[model samples]
Structure formats: structure tokens, C-alpha cells
Target: MLQFKLVLLGDSSVGKSSIVHRFVKDSFDELRESTIGAAFLSQTIKIKAEEQEEDVVIKFEIWDTAGQERYKSLAPMYYRNANAALVVYDLTQKDSLVKARSWVEELKNKVGDEDLVIFLVGNKLDLCEGEEDLRAVDTSEAKAYAEEQNLLFTEVSAKTGQGVKEVFRSIGEKLYASKKDEILAKKNRELGNRVNNSVDINAQRPSTNDTTTCCS
Candidate 1:
């Protein structure tokens, strides 16, 4: 399986842990407590490749960081070597979106846009249903900003399990596409080396010719 590190960043109560739980366990907790420094979890997804292409499995090593201001300084430690990031925001809180954008900028500066896959996630969709007025961050506005920054974007409700799976699925598919060939080549090289090493060991064993003692 191809493994990648992913981190979540956003303001408090934006539902990062909720999203992770919904995806990994397919469950939700309304009273979920806020994360401390960070939480670690992992989920593996398989992407069905096109015809003649190799099917790939991606394991996401998720670092769900705390959103509290006190923990902000530790954000870089989690996101430092991450392969992907989900910058989440509350759909009902405009300020969360602002904070999300700041996280995106920091990610770009620290992780580099070329090396990282980022998704701008608007969480708490369940709260906005049948109550569009409650949504403080407009979808179009967020989408436009995502497009400008070249990010994958989605809106999800961890409570209702809406669009949650698709978010990770999209990330898996894209990361596989971008890194598959290189990873495959590296795997092949490693396998070749192992085979060669085994052959060399066998060759070093006492040969039948050497085993035959010379007659007096």
C-alpha cells in the first residue's frame, strides 16, 4: 500500500475530529471533546485504476491537530512532512473560513504547493440544510478562493455523513495518480535489489566443485 501523511487544520469546533471519525469509523459524536495537541488515526482507501492500470491502495496517516490558540505553535510539527492537508472551516462561521485561509497560506509556505495536496473543506453542512441563511461562508466564495489557490474543495457534514467519504476518495485518487509511477518504479528497484542480494548469498555458499575433495 502507498502511504501518505495528512494533517487537518482549522479553528476550534470546525469538526476536524468529527470528519475523521465519520470517515474512519463511520460514526459521529455530537458531544465530541476538543482535541489536545493532536490526534493520530489512519484509514486506507483503494482506488480502482483504469483498464490496464494497476489498482492502488493508499493509507492516509492522519494527524488531526488541535484548533485552540494555545496549540497553534505545534501545528507545524504535524504538518511538516504531510503529504496532504485538509483545511476545514465551519459553514456557519465566517471567521473559521478566514482562519482556514491562513492555514492554507502557512501550508503553502511551509510545505510548498507543489509537494502537498490540499483540500479546502467546509464542514457542518447538516446545520445549513433547509436553513441556507445560516451559512455565513458562501460556497461560491470558498470555491473561487480554492480554485485560485489550486486546491481540491468540498462541503461535508460529519453529522450526516454527507460528502465525507468523497473527500478522502478524491484525495486518494489524485495522490495515486500523481505518485503511482514513481512509487512503482521505486518498489521495483527495491525488489530487484533484494533478488540480487539473495542470488549473491547463494553464490557465496560452498560450490559443488569446491566440495569435491581432491583425490590423493
Candidate 2:
């Protein structure tokens, strides 16, 4: 079993808590309270490899951070060692997307890790279902920026459970793939070291033809 630290970042009331809750508990709250500082949650997911017989168990230690501007300074502490991040924005609020972009920038500059898996998530799709007029953030624009920045992009509705599962599943798949790659690299290094050591031993040992005849 492998554990990963996952963090959520966005402006306040963008349904960061709601998304986490929906994924972890499979439930949604209409009047979900605002998160103060950060909320901690954990969920385990099993990822099966298409080409392999074994399944990987991933345990996510989720930190649903408070999105208020006042808590902005404290975000780094929560996301310090995060393996994956969800930078969420409300589809109905264009400014939320702007804030989401800022969050992404901060993560890149401060977190400073090329291996971090980030998703630019547009939330509140339920609000734009029939009334597309309510959607303030254009999906294509967000997607374009995500592509430019090398981020995973998706829109999800916590209320209707649309695309919610896929978000976490995508994260799980990426994390599992990264872990597998890391393990393989480590094994390769170990094998290389063993081969080198074996060669060194052979070079240092006396050949049978060169051995002295002790009792001759």
C-alpha cells in the first residue's frame, strides 16, 4: 500500500469541501459550511494496471485547505509535500478561474516540483447544465491554459456527481503510474549496482588457470 498527500486549493465557497466530501463520502451538502484553516480526510482507492495482474492500493491523505485570502499564506504548509493538487474554480464565477490561475502559478513557483500532478478543475457544472448562460468560465479557455501549463483539466459537478469520480480516478491513475515508474527505476539501479559488483569481484578473483597448486 502506498500513501500520497493530496491538497485542494481555490477561492472560498468554490465547493472545495464539497468536492472532497463527494469523493470521500459519496454525499453532498447544499449548505456545506466554510472550512477554517484546513480539513483532513483520507480515502483508499485500488488502481488496476491494464497490462499487469497486480493492483495498486493508494491511500490519499487529503487536505482540504481553506480558500480565503487570509489563509493564503498558510497554504504552502499543507501542500508542501503534496503528490497531487486540485486547483478548483467555480464555473459560474469568472473571477474564481482567475484566482485558480493564481493558485496554479503559486504552486509552480513555490512548490517548485516538476513531478507534481495538478488538475485545473472547474466546479459547479450543475449550475450551467440547462442554463449555459450561467457559466462564466469558458471550458476551452481553461483547457487551453491547462494544456499550456501541463495540467490535467476537467469540469465536475459535486451536486450531480458528474465527473467527480473521474477526477479522483485520474489522480489515482497518475499517482500509481508515477509510483510504478519510481519503483522500476529503483530496481534498475539495484540491478546495475549488482552487475557492477559482480564484475568487480570477478576482476579481483584469481582465475582457476592462475591459481597456485597448494599440495603439488
Give per-residue CA lDDT, model 2, range 25-90, as digits (tens).
Answer: 999999988999999999988888775678766778899999998888889999898999999999
Q: In model 1, where do residues sit more than 4 Å from their true spots?
A: 51-54, 131-133, 187-216
Q: Lowest-scoring 10 consecutive residues by lDDT in candidate 1?
A: 204-213
Q: List the residue pairs that clash in candidate 2.
A: none
- TM-scores of all predicted structures: 0.85, 0.84
Instruction: Give a tens-digit lDDT track for model 1, residues 1-216.
Output: 678889999999999999999999999998999999999998988888773266667788899999999999999999997889999999999999999999999999887548689999999998897945588899999999999999999999999999999999999888877876776666566668677765544244432212322453
Task: Identify the runs in model 2 with alpha carbons over 4 angstroms from their true place.
Answer: 184-216
Best by TM-score: 1
Shift in Å, residue 145, candidate 1: 0.3
lDDT for model 1: 0.88
